[model samples]
Target: MRYDFLIIGSGITGTMIARELSKYDAKTIVLEKENDAANHATSANSAIIHSGYDPDPGSLKAKLNVEGNLLYDVLEKELDIPLYNNGAFMVAHDKDEEGLLQRYYERAKTNGVPGVEILDQQQARALEKNLADDVTKVLNLPSTKVTYPWEVAIAALENAVDNGVSFAKNKQVVSITADNEGYTVKTEDGTTYHTRYVINAAGAYTEKIAKMIEKKVPYHITPRKGEYMILDRRVAGFIQRTLYPTPDEKGKGILMVPQYHGNILIGPNSEHQASLDDVSTSKGGLKIVKEGALKLAKNIPFHKNIRTFSGVRASSSHKDFYIKESLEHSGFIHVAGIDSPGLTAAPAIAKYVVDTIIRPKETLIDNKTFNPCRKAITLYDDMSAEEKSVAFQSDARYGNLVCKCERVTEGDIVRHIHRSVNADSVKAVKKRSRAGAGLCQGGYCEHQVIKILAREFGKTPLEINYFSDQSNILKNETKVKK
Candidate 1:
């Protein structure tokens, strides 16, 4: 089918663009390579909405990050996603680090970031008691926030799909050829899509996708891996705000991120990788995270660490965000090399792409029926007794708790499975509903989730995958079915 816009990836940037374009009367479609959306870098990260202080003064990361940080006030309300605006602290361990904090404060002012100030050690320690003993000063950024990164992508894409945008999974674009009318994007599965404007937001694969059409792409993208650790919810209140250990050349060093869903996240030590697929965490990488996290906050319950994972960032040779139309290909837009602060800048980036870049070139009418609101998944634990009774009356599955750690009910999992962007895999379900993302890490509830998925998808337990198509949880049936 010919579309007005064909988005190459389903990450936060692509999905946000899709959601923005859905407000127009254009035929937009988002193509994802994996079996689900946001399975890569978007799903794994620090999940911090940066305050726009770290990026250089006149860069796109600075301009869009400040704008995007403010847009979340409306996005969280419209999309029904939880956003924790608890703010962050950039701790300065000594006098030298205090100088760096002052420089960041000036940069924040230059970038038009609001509500930034430096607090003395006594005042800083008053706000957060877990600071390291050597802390001399703190740079307070009240605009910073935390959220469920993957859930934001999912919510945006789901709202986009509901507003007439099409989304397809497992559609890896292998080749792109320009024609008189438009471009033909052919996937690995022999499927072809004809679109006038192609948006290359393919995260780590952005450079490769650009090379398919333009022989001499201006920039090269190398995948940089950042390993992270998630502490159990029991340690959620250990820190009230995201804590940073100042800035370094590698990127924002290890941070103590208070995730929106009552979990503490740490690590994300940066290291360049030769391959984009190398998201594997190492003992050495994790050791750096453990030691670095100690500098920001003392007496952290390391025993509460529940999971360790890594995400690959699309680091470009340009040293800044490469956002512009291809000089050789008129309609092709490249939103590449969006590494750090990419999550915080996504909303503004989408607006710029749709309103500034695309609209001036092409005439687009408003989609009159577009609705920004997406129905939020009900958390059984958050419901009142009366609400719970009403939910149980409507669906008996509401009474059955599938995930004891998170208090997720069968009804919650089923609703996510039947949403606009369905959760077909165990990981997808976990991202949307937090069914298996608790202390036990799915040990107690994975089998039950598999059973539910089998019944809902009309397949046997062996067919239910953990995330990818090849990573099936059940290798074979142990016994004969009755």
Candidate 2:
């Protein structure tokens, strides 16, 4: 396909850029290597929207984080995504750590982060009663928030697609060649895309994509893995706010996060990995996470843990976000090495790329039909009694419960299955409708989901995949169909 802009990777960075570009009159497409959007780091993480106090004062991470944090107020309403400004507490267990809290407070002020204050031990304990007894001080960042990171990326892409942006899944870029006319990008599936400007937002493999045109790229990416555990909603009110340890060189240490949903999240122990694909959780890593969580809060019911997962971060050697037009290639822009604060900084970074990097190079007229709003899926549990009765009258599927764990009705699953982006796989449906995200972790509802997907897509149960094309859920028919 020929286009004006071709964005690689459909993570938060790429999708946000696509949404931003959708406002302009241009032929733009986002190519995602995976079968679904946000299949990597965007899908798995702490989901914390950092308040911009941690990064170095003059760095891009700090600048964009604060700017992007402010954008969520509008984004939450426009996109219909859930956002909780429950705030965060950086606990100090000793006098030395209290000194560090003061330093962070000063940095927060310089970074233009509002509502930052230091609370005494009594004040901190009063707010979060479960806090460890040794806590000497606390840095309260009221601007810090929690959200569904994958939902943000999904909503952005959906909105962009609604406004005339094209999205192609499993289109991994294999090679790139530049010419006077434009650039040619070929994928592994033998499809080729010709575009005038290429935005490289390939996440962990961004440096490799940059090196495709230039042997000596400016930056390098080191994939670092972080492991986490999700506690059931029974522990929802166990911690009122996200709790963190003092900042360290490795990154913000393990945190106890109260998710936007009723669940609680804890233990994202950072560890550098030799390979980007190594997201397997380890006993040692979980142990580190458990130990770290205990320091900030007491009597954490580890038995309530529902799930354990990990995500690899595209940690750049430069120690900051690497966003700029390629020096060797004129039209190629690299949005790489986005790690800790990347999620929070995505909106600002997208604006910068579209306005600063791409606009000056070409004449982009406004897309008169551009629409920023993408209605959220119908959540059965959030409906009022009258609304539920009306919905049930319209579609009998609303009366059928597919996921009792999460109160996900068959109607919810079907609606998300046919969205602008569409949920083709079981995991995709789970991410969209929350059918399999509850305490049982799909154990009770997965088969029902599989059957519903099969019915909706006109495929046999055997043909349905758990996630990607290869990971089929039902291996074979146990007994021959009667």
List residue ranges in candidate 1 displaced over 4 A.
Answer: none
**CA-only RMSD, every prediction:** 1.1, 1.1
Candidate 2 stretches greater than 4 Å from native: none
Question: Residue 186 in candidate 1 has what lDDT?
Answer: 95
lDDT of 1 by residue, 308-417 (tens): 99999899998888999999999999999999888889999999998788989988899999999997977867888999899889999988999998889999899889
Q: Summarize candidate 2's per-residue lDDT along 81-197 as a digit string, tens digits.
A: 889989999999888999999999999999999999999999998999999888999999999999999999999999999999999997889999997778999999999889998
Clashing pairs in 2: none
lDDT (0-100) at residue 230 of candidate 1?
90
